[model samples]
Target: MTATVTEQVFRLPDLGEGLTEAEILQWRVNVGDFVTVDQVVVEVETAKAAVDVPIPMAGKVVRLYGEPGTSVAVGAPLIAVAVPDERYREEERAGSGNVLVGYGTGGGGGRSRRRARVRQRQDEQPAASGPGKAASSSKSDPLLGPVSALEGGVSGAVVPSVSTSRLAGTPQAGEAAKPAETAGGKASGPGRKTAAKRMGEVPRVISPLVRRLAEEHGVDLTLVTPTGPRGVVLRRDVEAAIAASRNAETAQPEVAPAAAAPSHESAEAERVPLVGVRRAIAEKLSRSRREIPDATTWVDVDATALVELKESINRACPDARIGMLALLARICVVGLRRFPELNAYVDVERQEIVRLPHINLGFAAQTDRGLVVPVVHDAHRLTLAELAARLRELTADARDGKLTPQQLTGGTFTLNNYGVFGVDGSTPIINHPEAAMLGVGRIADRPWGYEGEVRLRKVTQLSFTFDHRVCDGGVAGGFLRFVADCVERPEVLITHL
Candidate 1:
């Protein structure tokens, strides 16, 4: 008699970086399509790059939870697969190893009898003899002697033994393993059974190229073991091995020719699909520009005194390490306090303007992933030293892709310092719902007539944009002038407070 098949749901794996979310770019396999283990099932665009997720088991896809363009959180079910026999289900519940799914590992089901036999056979075979038996023997033989060393001491490398335990285990070492007992020491569900069976079939071996390269480069492959399929050394594993060896060499390093040469054959422009944070930023900016009847007013201010102030403050408090951006943020906070109207947000749903008592100043930081606006919450409450420290923390988090949703939200006003890029000035779009945005331009030494005498002074441009319905040109201009006045004579800011 034939056994009945059961369907199990497969979830999206944590793509490392502790990223809890990702956007689905496309699905390679659809419902009812037969997929084998390690076959690419879907393409996902991570914050870092486009990556293909491999199917964990050989089965027919029964269902898909999301479509292209949909954003999904980690651990959310992505696909469903049907497996033959309740026996497979039973094995999954046995607390067996985990199966590789996409870029991560999932709880495994029971191992199949046939798979167990194959593994037994392979394990029984002598490690010294295999397809590359002659080569292995020759390399291992001490009589053959050591190979010639390269300029940097890179010589004959040996293929490292792969460690299946690491790949099957958690990404980090020393973490507590999940308990086998699932509600009274029985298998929690059928999904675990399927996961166990799949993991049992995965083969562990280092890639041939990685092994050869390791030997050629005199890299200790053992130091860079594979974390994929059994103990297969992946390309990344080999590269890491090489890097480790190079770092161990000398205090001062010599550059390698391979490192200097560009790897890509063509200088093709890489096209990035607009989605996630980039998409959200574009949509918000577009809506703000279209609906906010924005008008920008600029002011040229002598920032020479402000530069001197920053230098003196840095000397007094070496640990604080304050910067121009922090000073500008402080000035913006003071100006917002004076012109409380600019610190208000438009409540379109309620058809009313909501004024905020506390300042949440958003700083636009450019990251390799995209532009991120990390807000400095309760900016008004923070001192200059505290504000600088907070800004530094937020900037570092943003670049590292570690900022939380709260850090990216709830901004009454945004400050884009185009001066960092050496740009003079440009009109910046307002952050949606917020009434205004402030743009800081490059600070340069320019000739200015002060009391009928020409003198070189550090000058910068300030541009402010506000929603016309909430703020008229006069109000916007006054706000910009106030900021310029504070920056030009920064001492006035402290006195106003």
Candidate 2:
């Protein structure tokens, strides 16, 4: 027998949340290029992040179904591959490399053990019925014969067509039997014309919501066996599959029971479809919340000096658009240095507090979708100008939804500038795993004691929430005081550096 070349198509992997589709950013390997397993084959941009998609199997790329910049649906063919090895085809038929099916190969390559067959009533047809009888039966009975053909065959050839004139002549039946063109022009077969007219009328098995959820979770709905009415894939079925995946992951060793609940929405929502960045953000935030204990404290500060300092800096660097928020972030880094305990996270599973030497500050920005905390790595080392430039770049990218996973991870502490919203002050939730969060309020003219004299001054409130389990009130209070002092004496921040 001639060696068969099994065509393999790689679909987009789950980018988290129901991010059903992605814009192909670039094709790393063009048609005919040989690629190895796990090689970066394409770059795709979802709403949440730009991700590099890897090749699942080593093969020669035969064709690309979609071009760069085009949005392709999840599970749609991305690239076709042809493996030269004959053994690869045999292995595939024997179910090797069927990772998508949840059965992965274990090093030694032999034919996969066959599964025990489950007897089905349909598989055992009436012994009295032969192929000829079945074919004749299918031709005569419009419902029984043709319907069997429609179910068994990929092509709809088994459907029979009736004359549209006969259908149209009967006001109701004619309306039902609309004109439908077949490959042969003439519509023949029972319900052929009706089926064609109703093809658009047929209720699709997958709903828009189901599709959206599947896309977010990077789930191949085709692989998800449906449990809905009429074999339609339901949203709940997809969610259950996701939950089962999480449960399996949690069962792994050395992980806390609480941490086992991999980040996802409550299984109770009417429609919780994992999609895009939202799904990823949910998982990370969930993990943080479960793994950390947080505490918060507030301090009112006179920001008159910092406001003046910003004006002075703006004058010195004409091109730099320095803002109070960036100045506040700089002070936070200086404060975190003095109180290093606040610049660490509690690894509950390991029962250890990780004290990071570098200060990677995460700034919370409000996006149209939700809150995203994009980080500035090594914030302590950067000068004011460098910090301002990096902050500007991060904020711009966060708003435009261009942030990568790297830019969002590894934050030792976070600052939520609620001040921009013109609010006086409110306690901000801790961006968990990190022990604390600082909320900055808007500066407004208020009466304050300066050198024992009550006078009008530009004042702002700062709410610092820390993980009390890790650090008590004294440590948390001291950290807040240090940050407030830095903001009050803007020059002190420069001295601390």
Candidate 3:
């Protein structure tokens, strides 16, 4: 079964919490492209949304799996990154306890650092800002943001703050210098090569599985030469070393074949793969229908006064942008406070209703990617302006595909303004694990009976869906009526405000 990599070389991220896979949406960084640590390598879509995935190493990408729209499972190898240099791979593997050379933090006190005295001429000293610190030529490495290193220079000196040292081996005072050290940190002279050979260092192995195989077979890695790109030890090399040790003379070195292609049976249909957030959504919705006895209740309300109040407030404070959604959010916050039972989930195993003390209000916002719910933490604590501002920020981030995982989950109750779609009402499914979801339909002009006569009024439909196991229509109806009254008479929110 092992074609190359011996099996499971490098794998995709483990999306814990029962999620087993992600579908590749697109590649942000291509093969042969150099990437820094934490650089976004790909944009992967889970059922929840499209999330930008970052690679955790500084290297040139050697390999990546599949084209866009490919579905990969957890623990599957997504890409193989060939690290930049031997020292980088070693330092990264051995852990940063022994600080790796050639890396500099930024400059200090507006002053550059003193360069290391490694093989530099006596008169070629750099200019010093004060008495102690010498000037440095520095540029930040993408691997570490704001992490400026000495240009062409590798330092062993401990300096304070960021490094603003001159480039390694760069002649500061216009003098000809010896051949600079190679990217492998090897000096030019024969004597330096001898010294490097004497030094003890760990062998460069990217895959943990490779190291494990070598250890299991009793093969010494230092004795085996590397064959992978950029001096990385591949699994085949280790296997070759093992064969040589066992047979000694009769065994020949074997090169591993490429990973086997999928059999014709693996070819799937045109249907969408059920995984990540999408699979999770399906399971949750299905479970909600199966486990929780749910019901929907609707009401029509006269929102003419709420609209008039919104206009008056907008005119009064032109600087503050308080939207209708924010007003509704505030109303929901108060309504939930009045009827707190709706702000809870079912503890299935314990057979109990878990009422949350704080509220994380999730509101639906549609973007080019798809519809998403961005949650507002502690919605009970935000003012109308604050709520509107947060909503604007989250919605903007959603549109730009920059929402964090935390912002997408942990919603206590949902506020769905389906009204934007030009619809009247919907039997909105409750966000699972959430006890309820409040849906607001389009508010339009309609004939209504006022105090003494028929008049044109702004009317909208409100639909409240809840878990019947948590409460009957009594509590659900009460919460709906409270929100409706608040919408009709905006002044009534003063007591809660």
Question: Against the true structure, whose lDDT is highest?
Answer: 3
Question: What ranges in model 1 sit over 4 Å off?
Answer: 1-75, 78-271
In model 3, the runs with Cα more than 4 Å from the true position are: 1-10, 14-18, 30-33, 82-281, 367-370, 399-404
The CA lDDT at 482 in model 1 is 83
Top candidate on TM-score is 3
lDDT, candidate 3, 1-497, per-residue tens: 21111111235665433445566666787544676655677787666666666655555454455445445666565655544345344435644221212112110121112222322322134322222334353444343223223222212111123121221223455444433233466454534323423453334322443555777878776666767543445566877887667665444455456754543433322323343455566787787787777799999999999998888888998766878898999999999999999999999999899999999999988877566788999999988888889988998998887775567878899999999999999998888889999999999999999998999999999999999988999999999998988998988886667
Which lDDT values do the candidates have, in the order given?
0.65, 0.64, 0.65
The sequence of per-residue lDDT tens digits that candidate 2 reaches over residues 324-385 is: 87888888988888889888887778888888899999999988756788999999999878
Clash totals for all candidate models: 16, 26, 16
- In order of appearance, the predictions have TM-scores of 0.52, 0.57, 0.58
In model 2, which range of ten residues has the least summed lDDT?
112-121
Q: Can you write out model 1's per-residue Cα lDDT over 1-497, one digit (the tens) per residue?
A: 44455555567776643255565666798655676656778777555334567755555565555445445566766666666645434544443333323333233332322222222233323423333222211112121122111111111111225343332232223333341223354334434323433444222333334445667777654455555433444555666766666555533444598777545443334334354567667777788877788878888889998999999999999999999999999988988888888899778788898889889999999988888888999999998999999999999987877665557777899999989999888888888878888998899999987768999999888888888878777778877888888888887887977
Error of 2 at 34 (Å): 12
Better lDDT candidate (1, 3): 3
lDDT of 2: 0.64
